[model samples]
Target chain A: MESKEINLPLTDKAIDGLQIGDRVEYSGILYTARDAAHKRLITLADAGNELPVALQGQVIYYVGPTPPRPGRVIGSAGPTTAMRLDPYTPRMLELGVKGIIGKGGRGPVVREAIQKHHAIYCIAVGGTGALLNRHIKNVEVVAFEDLGTEAIRRLEVDHFPAIVVNDAYGGDLLEAGKAEYRTKAPPSP
Target chain B: MREIEAGVITEAVAKLAVEATHFLPEDVEGAIRGARETEQSPLGVQIIDEILENAEIAREQMLPLCQDTGTAVVHLELGQDVHITGGFIMDAVNAGIEKGYGDGYLRKSIVAHPFGERKNTGTNTPGVIHTEIVPGDKIHIGFMPKGGGCENMSRYQNFLPGAGREAVIKFVCETVDQSGGNPCPPLVIGVGVGGTAEKAMTMAKHSLFRKIGQRSEDPEVSILEKTLLDAVNALGVGPQAVGGSTTALDVFVETYPTHITALPVAVNIQCHSARTKHTVL
Candidate 1:
């Protein structure tokens, strides 16, 4: 796998050279959703309903950021656990969502769907809410206004960062990394 | 008995909510640093670095460690000798929760109902407060704002009397391993052994307030903590489950003798942020 540095408004062709574990700095439009939004999205897809926004080749970020401070465009925004959205991910991928920005490990089903659908699971630094939000320059509630923090939001980010934990070729950085570091416990006397 | 003003309680709670959310306790900071130094995965080290950096930024900028500041769970040990004045005890705590979350700009996470029309209370008010009457002249407050990720991963298992320690160990390790990366890594494992089912779970939640890496005095349980810690880390769930050897920074176990028929255990996994504060008034 070759490592390459790429710049803004990323497209699938531009990111083709990256592999699992490769670091990438992204500067583009990022979408946000929590459990409620994901459920709503799944319902829409099942109903063959038009989505609030076209997800074609877009990156969906799993986050429910705090309310922004007085002057900031967005508050502390960070990746949330991805597994909770596992059930809805395949459908999103089928709809042309290209990448998922989140933390924690995705289930085997989601990983397999990523391989089948040419999508990628990218992990942003979890718990680094305030620092991560620094990269976000604009934030607007796109839908689900009544959900409060759980509302779907659209954010414009600059050099927002992540690592590919699961890729389009059935590779999982989580299991591979674990295999590299796990130590066997000693036998009892 | 001396009378203490409800306003004092309210003020203390308000300060505690903001402070606990905005700042990482010294012990928690130390634990994260320690994990960073000892973690084997390059990714894990990187994750810890960002977590520590996040802590610093949150404090300096007055931002929360995570967007989920969580519901304010307060445990109050009120002194029997002290009488409250000005207002009801619960009212004072609610006021504090309201002001703290409001002024701090933290997210309001609580809903009026778990089922049916879920409605946001807006103020993050009516904190889950547990009151215990104790013999003392001052009221002691312990604040633990638990995140949804970890709280959602909590487990309760009821083992038969013959199940013994191995069963407890297996149950806990499996729960953490199954949790994968979701609970946030370098998790604080809180084990409540013995007591009734509800007590065991509450003890599990309350156990999170213990200082990081601090072990119970019970020699047996102290050893159990070490064993559990080693087993959990062995899962290679590392920070954020990105995979590493230091998945759990510490494990705390609190126990009480139980009915001969019961050997209940509850495991509560806490995220690395570990927000908690202690105040005596």
Candidate 2:
């Protein structure tokens, strides 16, 4: 339930301290990467080659936004499901990525990566692409433009709203919250 | 037999496809707003508000309500006494899909193959069409744009003859609960029971086109829908399955007679953005 507006140069402590369900107003540079871009990023990091952009303390938003209408900065820019990028997230975190934003819960591998790397996973509301895009102040393609919406775009954001779903401390809001509310079938009467 | 021109049906199908994809039906919008009011979680409330805002943007910008745009699913109720002239009805439907997807700038999501050499169709055509002939002069077309996220989560199960209603209910709830926050929640659960596997699944998908909160025509099925809806919401999957009071917006069940040995059921979980439209001509 804690709320805070954040700016860049985020520390591991700053991200790891968050718990599930905390509201964040993120204002700073966040990069967009989806399935294809995440693969490319990992390859570059593995090859010991320079990344298209620095990952240290950077936030990556998993999205494949629709094309923007003429005169609009971006189109419906919501978080895609997180599990699609679960395979690549731990690698990114190890390479110094600070926060991952998307919808849906991540797998054990990703949760472990967050704890080990002190990174965070934020849940941006799904299907709110247009509303979410309004928070982007500026956007530029950093790499993989041929991936269409899946390209890596460097986005400048202001108070982009999301909930801390998973944090470095190992709090998983999706799991904990669901467990609290899951009504088990009543024992045989 | 009364003859109708292919041009007429083609135009209608195209318009229906574009309209269904471009606009979120009014009832669907209303249901989301209603869910927003009743949802208890603070995060859920914020998410609902953003969804509402997204709807406005989609309308103002004339963009597809969701980027998925979806696979074109056309359901046709053809009159027994009528004959189509100039072209095949299926041809008209495919042409309509192409025109709609091309002209609307929607993402053509259909693939030529599943599993290997998966390639985009370029134009969203060769729709999943179902036709039923009935005693009438007019044609009734239902256009449902089925998105991938929810479609991927759809399930079909064949229950033992003795599994009964409780098993069916458990299956639906378990499936949706497992899909928490993934199918993009505040979902409408469409349950199809008592048919063969494929038939059951199709019925479940078509059941999504039912008006939100409307009861099934069969009283037993209506009761089942209510029971399932209550049980699913009780799961607290909530908006975006992030936890709240409103996991499923409604549950609509469609059933048909089945073989003596099987009690087949299919659950087609759809997100809040259930895009569908219908026209009679």
Candidate 3:
């Protein structure tokens, strides 16, 4: 499959153009956050306070990396489960978040929000952290260093690979992909 | 009685934590490679290849295989005649985990309280260590850095004895279907049956150490393993849940006799990053 090269600060046009199952190489910035960091961000946003990480027109990568060993930039960085971030996604989209990177299927609320807010969802293979970290060239802990791995960080990545699983126009690659193969699959033994 | 210093166990456990995090077991690595050939979806095959590549990169660089790094689950087979000197068994094991996580650059994932403050313990410890007295003078320890993704997908139930084999078949298949890509398929499915609730869960987790194609010693249990394996693969959840021909590399079932009226089952999933290491002392 030919991977479409996607530039960062995803344009509205670029977001609309993606379809489920399309492979893409992302070159730009991804803000890191998981359960704890997400909680603090949303809690701040709810109080109508200034947010730490820039959200508008940016992609948020759901990940928590290990401590870097010696000279490495970051250690074993890979996506955490995206579904855990579902509750905050609508507001994140409302705050002009353009894309999300994570693993596994999302619940309906987030899927609907992705379509409503004109955003996209993509997945990198989970547990492929060792390989994935190679793409992340730099990291700065922008928020919540006290949370350690769960801290929010600004990351500069180069040619990072992922597959589009959900897009603005309502396509889901995971479900469609499973259905296609299930038909040909032998009945349960 | 033979005596071994508890400090030795601590050092050994530390090495195990690092080794388990960095290397994918050979059988697990081999199974994923084999899954690539049988995987039907182009996406599934590509994902499987990435996993294999990740395994090599982690081993060479001494990187923790996954960011989750995992809650270290250690199984100790302690010999009846062996005496552990110097300190407590679990305390030493926990110290080893602290040293491993600190020294190896692995993440500390354990929370202090499940319900309450939920503060990270800062060391991946009190690694769910299980010790059982056994029949020899040597000690055996098995370590698995059990990641959260697949562990979250695990399920347990107490079935009515009348539910029987068909019920189990249904439960096992449904679990995989619901798990989808969350457990990071292609998976190694571990099933524990015919025990009490806790025993069933422990056995399910323990069975994951079995290599692919290794069956239970019991003939009847072996057949059930094959049957469950076929049914799970037929679900087409595929590698990384992108849909393909190979959802599971193997289905390992471990059984124990239980009460006449109760039939308990636990399904534990091992993701493609299937990591574990063991040592005998």
Candidate 4:
């Protein structure tokens, strides 16, 4: 169970080194986006217009965090379901996006893109937002403020924990991990 | 008739929203701790540890347990003999939600329209409020902040009367299997059986408010709960679907008398967060 300490704007070497089920402590910048912001990003990309933030060699976290209370940098910030972003993921990867952070299994197209683009997909513990928020050091809205929480935010995170669920080599931990632990179905009642 | 002020209802619901978001109910917390100890996979154990740690941090700092904060669902048990004063009950509940979501810094997740513009309401108003008239004079309010991930995984089916207990067992297990890690296992599954389609769905959602590990009073229903729980845990979906022996914390079933020809069933899946709070006024 070797754990890797990686930074954002991930290097090609770093993405290549990741494997399904590998533990990772990610630090550095992470841009947050969920359904609404993702739609806007895809629209912008389709129109051949510039994106609000550069995508090259960067990681995007599929999250829409709670509003920060007074004196706090951010609120409970955790990953949303990832499958909803599948349509936009391949395009982002084509733009040199290095990694994605979200929960649950990704679609086939996104998985194919991960292998093709040599990108990685990681998952923070879903529903563990309070703990995850402690790892974030700074946050600022970068685009789509009209979407409110769904607005894209540039974040600086330190020791933000996650496990690789999809690797650049066409491995998927969600399938492999469950297969390894699956037991015989109980007899019919 | 006893009179209760609208502001009182608003204050109560407001507090409930914040507390339910920040605190994992005692039963749910206990189940997670128990799951951590018994979980066979190292990865599962690690995930459970993080979940418990998150709960601790949320409780200590008064921060929300998850980023979703969820769509506020308020269930009200209004006594027949009691009178609501000052304003419309629905408005007061909505006002409470606005205050709670605003004051607690919870996310305003409600959208104005399902289709078309898809604009956010900005205020987490018009909470999904369910009301029932009861015998007692005191009103009971149960507040549950339900996240979208798990709700998305819920399902309903109208099984033929011949479908039997085996069919149910299979359906529940398969649902969890298909959901994999998306519903955020280890989960609390609520099953509703023996009612009209809508009634069954409502029962399934309401059953989730029951304490974890509490069984239905009916002998046959309790057995079904146990059997479903065991079968689901056997799926090895584990914590976050990474793999483990503790996929489900518990299975709760609520049943009603049904027409002889119909056997409607519904499954409402709840994530490990399993947040709920109640107050009687």
Candidate 5:
């Protein structure tokens, strides 16, 4: 399958053009956040307070990387389960977050928000952290340092691999892909 | 009594912590490679390839096989005749965890409390340890670093005696279905039957320590394991739930005697990482 190379801070037009099952190699900047950071972001938004980092046109990767070993830019960094962040995703989408990179499927509301906002939900292989970390060139903690692994990070990546699971056109690769391979079980005796 | 030093246990556990995180066990690696060969979906094949590549990278570079290096779960089979010397066994294990996680650069994932505080433990210490007293003089330790994604998908139930084999199979399959791609399929399904609620759960976790493809010594349970494995794979959840024929690599069932009125079951799902290591002292 042909994989498309995409620059981060995706434009609405760029996101709209993508579809479920399309392989993508993402480059440029991607932000990192997991459940804790998501809660903080939501709380700040509800309080009508400014976020520590701007969300406009950025991609948030659901990940909490291991601490880097000596001389390494980062340690094994892979996607966490995306559904855990489902409750906080729609709001982030409303804030103009253009893309999400994580493993697993988003809930219904998050999918609908993706369609409405012309954003995309992408998945990196869940257990492939060591491989994924190689794509990251640099990392900086931008907020919530006290959260340790859950802290928000700004990452510069090169050709980071992902697959679009939910797209602006309401395409869901998880649903489509599963349907293709689903086999009927033998009748229960 | 055979005496074992605290330092010996700590050193062994420390080594296991790093080894379990960095290396994919041979059985697990073989199963994944088999899944890649049999997987029919293009997307499934692609994902398996990446997983295999990830294992290679992690092994070569001494990096963790997954970012969620997991809660350090240590299972100890202590012989009744052995005496642990120097310090408390639990303290030795925790000290080893601190050193291993810190030196290996594995993620410290444990929070201080489930509901309150939620502070990082920093050392990933106070590991969830399961100890059993058995015959003989050797101390056998099994180290399993279980990630949160798959662990969250686990389920337990207390069914009435009327709920038969079919119901148990149905519950196990449905749990895997609801889990879909979240637990990082292809997976290993561990089923614990006939025990008390907590016993069933513990057995479910312990069943994961068995080598992939190894079946229960009980012929009846062995058949049930096969049945559940087939049913789970048929769910069409596939690899990463993206679709394929290999959603589950194996199903391990461990059963114990229970009261005539009760039938308890617990299902523990393990991701493809399947990281485990063992030592006998």
Candidate 6:
């Protein structure tokens, strides 16, 4: 499959053009947040405080990477399940986040939010961290360091791999893919 | 009588913890390799290729296969004839986890409390350890570093005695269907039928140790495994649930004697990165 390479801080054109199941390689910057960091961000948002990182036109990767070894920039950094962050996703979109990257299917609310807010949901292959870290050139803790792995991080990247799971136009690759292959596909022989 | 030192167990645990993370078990690797030949969807095939490449990278770099690195779950079979010369076994096991997680640079995922502070333990101590006393003088350890993704999708059911094989089959298929892309397929579906609730769950987890296509010794149990494997694949959840074939590489069914009124079942879903390694001392 030919993968489209996308530069981050995604523009409306890029988000609008993406379709469910289109393979894409992302470059530039991606902010990292998992459960704890998300909760803190929402708390900050509710209190009318500034977020640690600017969400406008930026991507958030749902990951809690392992500590890097002696010389590495980042350790095994794979996507965690995205559904866990569904509750905060709409609010995140409302705050101007344009793209979300993680693994697995998003809930209905998130799918709706992605369409309404004109954001994209992409997925890197889960459990492929050793390969994934190769694309992440640099990473630094940006917020909530006490949360350890759950702390937010700013990641500089080059050609990070992902596939659009839910595109901005209300297309869902997960559901469509399943429906397409359910009948025509044969069991593994 | 054979004597074993507590420190030795700890050292072994520490070593295996890092090893299991770095190296993908051969059976799992082989099954994934096999998926490429069978996964019909072009995307699914690509994902399989990526997974295989990831395992290679992890081994070569001595890095964890996944960031979750997981909660260290140990199934220890201690010999009845052996005497431990040092400290308590559980304490030693925990010490091993702390050292391994710290030294290996694996993530400490376990929290201090579920409902309270929910603070990270800093050290991945308090690993889930289940010990069984057996007849031999050797201690056998089965270590599985279970990631949160698949563990969350795992299911347990208490079926009425009248609910036969068909109902059980429905439950397994439905479980995988609902799991979708969350557990990271193509999965290793471990089905434990009969026995009580806990026993079913334990058996389901332990059954994952078997190599793909390895059948149960009993003919009837073996048939159920085959049936479930086919049924799970038929659901079309595909690799990573993006769709195609090959939803599950294998469905392993382990059964025990159950009460006259109950038929308990557990489905322990293991992802493509099934990090399990065992040793006998």
lDDT of 4 by residue, B1-281 (tens): 99999999999999999999999999999999988889999988999999999999999998899988788888999999899999999999999999999999999998889897978888887799999999978999999999999999988988889888888888888888988888889999999998899899889999999999899999999999998998898887889988788999999999999998988889999999898999999
For the predicted complex of model 2, DockQ is 0.41
Candidate 6: tens digits of C-alpha lDDT, residues B1-281: 99999999999999889998889989889988888998889999999999999999999998799999998999999999988879998998899888889999999999989899987888987899999999989999888889999999989889889988886788888889999988988899888899999999999999987887799999988888888888888788899889988899889988999999999989999898888988898
Worst 10 residues of 6 chain B by lDDT: B228-237
Candidate 3: list runs displaced more than 4 Å: A183-189
Least well predicted 10-residue stretch by lDDT in candidate 5 chain B: B235-244
What is the DockQ ranking, best to worst?
A: 5, 4, 3, 6, 1, 2
Residue-level lDDT tens digits of model 3 in B1-281: 99999999999999998999999888888888887887889888889888989999998988878998898999999999999999998998999899999999999999999999999999888799888899989999998899889999999998999988887888899899988888888888899998799999889999988778899999999999999988888787877777778888999999899999999999999888778899999
TM-score on alpha carbons, each prediction: 0.95, 0.92, 0.98, 0.98, 0.98, 0.98
Query: Model 2 Cα displacement at A100 (Å)?
Result: 1.4
lDDT of 4 at A13: 91
- TM-score of model 5 (CA atoms): 0.98
Best by lDDT: 5
Q: Is the docking of candidate 6 incorrect, acceptable, medium or high quality?
A: medium
- Candidate 4 residue pairs in backbone clash: none
Native contacts recovered, in order, as a fraction for each? 0.64, 0.34, 0.68, 0.72, 0.76, 0.73
Predictions in order: chain A TM-score: 0.91, 0.94, 0.95, 0.95, 0.96, 0.96
lDDT of 2 at A42: 93
Quote the chain B TM-score of every prediction. 0.98, 0.97, 0.98, 0.99, 0.99, 0.98
lDDT of the candidates, in the order given: 0.85, 0.83, 0.89, 0.91, 0.91, 0.90
Error of 6 at B19 (Å): 0.9
Tell me how far the alpha carbon of residue A71 in candidate 1 is from the true structure, in angstroms, after superposition: 1.0
The better-scoring model by lDDT among 4 and 5 is: 5
Which of candidates 1 and 4 reaches a greater TM-score? 4
Instruction: Report lDDT (Cα) of residue B178, candidate 5.
Output: 83
Candidate 4 docks at the CAPRI level of: medium
C-alpha displacement of B14 in model 3, angstroms? Answer: 0.6
